[model samples]
Target: MTNQLVPTSGSPERGIIVPVPHQRPEHFDAETQERLNRVDDAAFEAIAEGRPENTVTAYGQDWAAWEKFCAETSVPVLGVTPGTLVWFVEWLWEQPGKKAGTYTAPSTIARRVTGVTVSARVDHKVKLEEGVARPARARLTQLKNELAKTRETRGRGKAPALKIPHLQLISAALPDNLRGIRDRALMLIHFSIAGREHELAWLRNRHITRTDEGLVVDVAVSKNHPRIVGIPYGTRLATCPVRNWDAWKTAVEELTGEPVDPDEFAFRRIHAKGKSLMAGGITPEAVGDVITRCGEIAGLDIRLTGHSPRRGFATEAVKKGKEREAKRQGGWSKTSRAFEEYVEEAGIFEENALHGIGL
Candidate 1:
């Protein structure tokens, strides 16, 4: 029989139709609706909260190390047991050093363990109950406490502070070449700006602006803080950052056969033989190496790192009786504990008020 809707009054002879209730289709086109259905909102949010590139790279390395150790010991990769963590902590503590006189520092061990713990908890989704977690925590805590006690007698081997005299020596010792000019500019700018290694590495020519006063650098991002600050031309032309910067820019322009673009990296690698400049900017590691090599040339018997310039700026400011200004200029937070240490180092012998008492 042909289907027909019946009237609600049920008069069979009259063929009045009653419409059946049906859900309406969505208004979106087929392709657009399908795309919307395919989107994983949770995944998008996870991606949005992702860490920095360097941090991700380090996590990859740390996870790899943990996996390798677990594989060798025939332990569960995804379900890491409390006993496995204890053994890993032991291995971290007693791991053989790459050099004869060195072993893994306590801080390094702590970082590795932290990385592994995060990987287990987040990546593997390992959830431990109180019974396992309590003992695991106890073991790790005991190990860390023991390590700290053993290291109590040792000194913190920080990078040696570079002063103006040291800078002058290092600058003078550089060979008179393209590399020399570049290094000179890098050193002077690093010392003057008091910027961290990554900030220096990421600098573009566009970030610098020249005014009647001097050159100002806009640090787009720094360690924990970012801002704009001016670094003025020094009275001592020999070690002036602005002069060195101009000389470097001129040299680069001559080599490239064009004016340097604003977006171009401020610093680039030089060929070891000093024949030509490399295409891209130098790494933070290379920046640290430059300071170390310069220190060797200047006959500084202490180890130097990338932090030397930033620390040097603070120390110099302290010595010049500009502690407050130095703290502000160096981008240190108001609650920073490091201010006292730099101040003490600056005034230990020369600027101390107690020296007049002559005890």
Candidate 2:
């Protein structure tokens, strides 16, 4: 049947049809509309508040993941509940790939979960202020509860600490030639200084100063604080610089095959096959790989990494400090967590026992 255009009750019957007024789409409910606007506002506010790019990127990725999950599950944003969040966490946990598609370490997962919970709580607060009825609780508390449940479902895994012998073995395994010497020196410096890999990588030749008394390393940047570390005249390492600075000077010169410039890296790149040196500094990954190779050479059946030297240094220094002025030479900050770790490793009573026993 052909459709006829009938006149409305308010219009004259001249067969003149009037256009219908446009209505907003029904897909966006009042709550959903509010949430969509809030999301846009929050994003703008986040940027305006000067949030770091990395942090903003992480949040964007996380929220995008949430939206994807919701769309797949046919869940509405305004209908999100704590139970929905729990399910989302489970979905994330069960995802295929390393660490269940999260690509995050355990500590990283913990941190990210905390962030998600915080975002949810913030959204919940916005809803509540808009007359949505719900009791408010801290996001941390919610995260802790969810984490406990998740852990209960998925059994905890153990992570092993790096071993010192493994590190020594790695060092021993490197070709005992020029590269070997450089690797050994690098390892020794890493352990002796207990420095971060980046700090070591960025270390310049001028940072190391030799005087009539001793050698001192001026650490321009550090985790806790910037400070100078000195090797006094009497120590074994000190003699190379204090008693005869030329020994270190000559060793460095021989390694580099040129007069070492003050602006050059303390450890310059040397070609494995030849004596030719490169101007650029070594990366942390290269340093770690070299250490791993050293472990293999030493015939040690354990894993090792660049960080081993720093941990080993802290362990050894704590042990050596028991009888002598233990705290003085390490150059550790009074408030540093390393101090606590060192003390824990070097038991106070065990240190006092030698003093108690008469020779």
Candidate 3:
């Protein structure tokens, strides 16, 4: 028999006819609909901001590189088969670096395939299969090993980790003035917290609390996540984070002739003449600038970045047998490879096999 359309309420003509699977539209109140719309906006925003901006931008560039390859090679952009993926990587490995004779760095090569896979799904709405992931990673590893043995390390690599001695030198080199006080507090607090640049940049006066021991800081452990960290009193008053912070706060109050509002920035830019404070807070990049200035003043050889304090904290903590505390304080996830690297650096000379044979 031929199939027939079924009518609602068993009426042949009154109700509309429907196919095999019938459906109906539903309505919600205006307030409920508005809330649903907000939920959608928030969900997407969260996904977008979930990763750090640099990672997102790097992946976007990686995807663009894949697109460029596909265009030149006449491969289908969406048709990312295992063979195509492997071919794309092989093609990437042959590309030139910024230098005349240098090839693409292994780190860049490592991220390309993963970036392409992510871009395929997130940008093009295609879910490439997982069939080639293992092979791709294996081949990438082999290429990295070969390149490591053959190539000279030429790039501006990881920033040197600052130590306590460097911190002391930086402190002494800063002038005996308002800006100097602010820089001192900033770097000391940064080290104390093992802070990310954005974390220090995000702080407000209210986030810091004065405790009997030291200051308790409320910080975002991740995007929109809050955690309280304790910064204890230091061995001496000169290099103490808490005392330095108090001095900075007092100086700012003295300059402005008004008490700092609870929501005001913990760190602010100073005037060039060193006479006044700027209206807005210093940025994340400014954190690095301050550290670099300090490094120059202290006459240190290694390049310093905002991340130096965090690196120092992790390395020193592991060196002192505070591995668990280091991870927790540094906000390093349990499986964080970067955190493990710091631990490795701290232990490279520990229980050395060649110690007994030393001169």
Better of 1 and 2 by lDDT: 1
Clashing residue pairs for model 3: none
Candidate with maximal TM-score:
1
Candidate 2 Cα deviation (angstroms), residue 13: 75
Model 3: which ten-residue window has the lowest total lDDT?
Answer: 17-26
**Which candidate has the top score in lDDT?**
3
Clash list (residue pairs), candidate 2: 169-295, 170-294, 170-295, 171-294, 173-297, 173-298
Scored against the true structure, residue 78 in model 1 reaches a CA lDDT of 68
State how far residue 240 of model 1 sits from its true place (Å): 1.3
After best superposition, candidate 3 residue 86: deviation in angstroms?
Answer: 6.3
Estimate, for each residue in 18-123, the C-alpha lDDT of model 2 and write its tens digit. Answer: 5554546466789888897778678756643564333445565666666777888887754556555555655555444344534323333344444454455453
Candidates ranked by lDDT? 3, 1, 2
lDDT of each: 0.75, 0.56, 0.80
Candidate 2 wrong stretches, greater than 4 Å: 1-103, 109-176, 232-252, 255-257, 272-274, 322-335, 348-359
Candidate 1 lDDT over residue span 1-359, tens digit each: 24456755566667766555543446678887667645644444465356554455556777786787778777777656667777766666566555565655555555666667666655554554345434555776787687678864112346678789888888888876898888888888888877778778878899978788888998775656677878888887768889888889999999989989898889888988897988888887788877777788778877778889988988988889987777667788876777678878988889667876978
TM-score of each: 0.74, 0.51, 0.70
Model 1 regions more than 4 Å off: 1-50, 72-75, 79-89, 96-100, 117-156, 350-354, 357-359
- lDDT tens string, model 3, 90-137? 788888887687667667776888788766765565646666556766
Rank order (by TM-score, best first) = 1, 3, 2
